[model samples]
Target: MDRITVLLADDNLIVRSGVRALLSRDEGLEVVGEAGDLESLIALAEELAPQVIVTDIRMPPTFNDEGIEGAKIVRKRSPGTGVVVLSQYDDPEYAVGLLTEGASGYAYLLKERIGDGGQLSRAIREVAGGGSMLDPEIVSALVSPAKDSSGLNAEQQRLLLQVGEGKAVKAIAAVTGQTPGAVDRAIGELFLVLARDASVGGKDALRRLRSLHTAILEREEQGETLSRMLPSKLAAKLRADPTASSRTERLTVTVVMSDVRGYSGIAERSDPGALAQQLNAHRQQMNAAVLSEDGTVMQYVGDAVMAVFGAPDPQPDHAERAVRTSLRMHELQRALDAEWQKEGLEPFGMGIGLSTGLVAAALLGSAERVEYTLVGDTVNLSQRLQDLARPAGTTVASESTVTAAGDRWQWEALGDHLVKGRDTPVAAYRLTTDTTRTEPTPSREEATR
Candidate 1:
């Protein structure tokens, strides 16, 4: 069993010690670090990258909403880390403010409710999994103030409650035994009904409902931050032209797909909390590698990382950039793995695949959630080649990618191999580095096939 890593923050040393002591009793939880102020909290968050952060809503320097501000910064910097805010006051306003940006990966609890530590433990676990939790009193405080003068039916009011709790459409559908489309329609209709009611109380309820509804919708996307999720410069273009993502464009680009070689075996043997920390570290390094070459990190699903070297902004040397990026990734991971080995943790080995061809790229989704994606055979081939890249730290590139990248490194022809979803076999090349050469030596070998 893996203990959940946590960071505690409070201006008062006694309070911090007491809370830490309480959490220490739980064998499943581990305190990795502590901070007394907002600045220290942010610094430790970036350094330790703990699974969860438990902090006082007020801290030193200002003692006013520092915890909330610090949590926001930590979340932006490390989107995977969850936050549980402890406050002496049970004011719903602070909770609302903390959650205004988004409610997922956030929890607000009254400090007085930490009697048995069960509630605090539960909240920590909830937000750690990208779920939201609010103190019962805070929920009541929020709901009681917003009078239901909009004349919502029983079913509609129930729907409102579920939405207020930050439940996703799919989750709500499963619970209510309704289709996702039906749930979405119901929510839209519910919003329309609220809009129709213009009474003072109705307006208050409507405002709160709108905020909650938006937050819940945004939760569907990973990172819960739209700007951060998009490719570099794509967000700016979308903002300048809101409809830029509405249409598809054909582009000649290079796609890179990398996956941890033995993630499943590692997961089965390692503690869940420790594995999460390791994964976060791996991802941060991979992200830096990709960004260093101006590649866009499309997504990180579990142990897999998908990146694109051209699309939102095309480059003539996309293939070369991807090849360089792949090598850099392997280099960075090796250093990271060395550090992990020192910590008595298993190091990660990545198998990367690169494919270059024409792909139809589009930003798809509704106003609430959107994803920039590449579609077509190019994308599929990259994933297929990635499967062929085994034995760890190896990179496989498609024939097309090899041609576009030019002769910069030695190549080992993989020959024509049949891949899934295709009737014909695809040609691939292994990007080989010379152990003798300190720098990349331009070379190419003729394939006899």
Candidate 2:
């Protein structure tokens, strides 16, 4: 299972320990960071960029509502971050303050009744999936004596919630068991209700809803547009918003070169259709992992994927981001492997390389076939390192990259070797993903000429 990265914050060590112990038992939850104050929580959230945050409702010098306040700031800065606020207070209004704008990707839980950590795990999973959950007591406190109706029927209210969660009409239809046409009608009615509310009270909230509505429309369009385009170097150009073309400039970057190990043998053994489908899925996983870290996909050569970090734009932490992204790519392949195995399909094994140094990056070629390319010794080293990583599902990085990354990741040095295209021996560090089993080290001679 690909574990969900979590950042835990609590001023009380005892409380933090209890929560950590409880969460550690769950195989799918990984507490990657911990903070003891609101400031620390915010700092760690940005630094580590965890998928979910669990924070005590009060902490720091104020010891007031710092946790809830910090959670709001986190969600504001990164809308995709899931926050679960833990509180000793049973006040439903406190929870309401944390979710006034929208309830999606937010959760409020009572610290006392976490109930063996199941509810905590469930809440994390729900918010991580862009859904909402509230303590049952909290829910009853708000809904038991239902407030005055706002002229929205139950179905219309549900549709409004879906829209706030950024679900497209087709997705809403899938969930509600309705046709797309019916969902469209419901959305129109919901919009009208929101418009009425905007004219009266809560105009600010309605404005946010309007923005989300516009997002849904644009997302639908983007899906259509992306479906018709080839996604590679052009995607990088568009994503980076590069202004110039055919102009090369020196850029310090982390270059990642990955290859699908044993692709030739798999191609010869598998049917053409099956092989094509596997390649498509593999590319999607690799591309998504790279793009998630703000890295640019440089190009694709057969079964190889080239990614550049800090190019088209300067990223000081490019080395760190590239190493972390490599781990995610490894996780992606493992998850894909399990799924494909269940269906009797060929599984993909990935070898990743990362080299951080100065490089020349620019757009090249005519309008008919333009591409954003990276050219430098760093690129060559990355390729050699990836070939050395051919022990499937492995990642190897240049010594310079490992040093630049600091203590962020655990690595096992694979010693010095003359990697092809380089005169001197370059030391390679293997990012150790599985600590329990000792992976075989690549022989220097086998790794290069």
Work out the TM-score per prediction.
0.62, 0.46
lDDT of predicted model 1: 0.83
- Minimum summed lDDT over a 10-residue window in model 1 is located at 219-228
Q: Candidate 1 at residue 69, lDDT? A: 95
RMSD, each candidate, Å?
A: 8.1, 15.6
Model 2 agreement with the true structure over 21-74: per-residue lDDT tens digits: 999889888887899998999999876667799999889979999998888888
Candidate 1 lDDT over 185-283, as tens digits, reads: 998887777767776465566666676666566555433334336764576566567577678989999999999998999999998767888887888
Summed over model 1, clashes come to 0
For all candidates in order, the CA lDDT equals 0.83, 0.75
Error of 2 at 265 (Å): 0.5
- Considering every candidate listed, which one attains the maximal lDDT? 1
Cand. 2 Cα-lDDT:
0.75
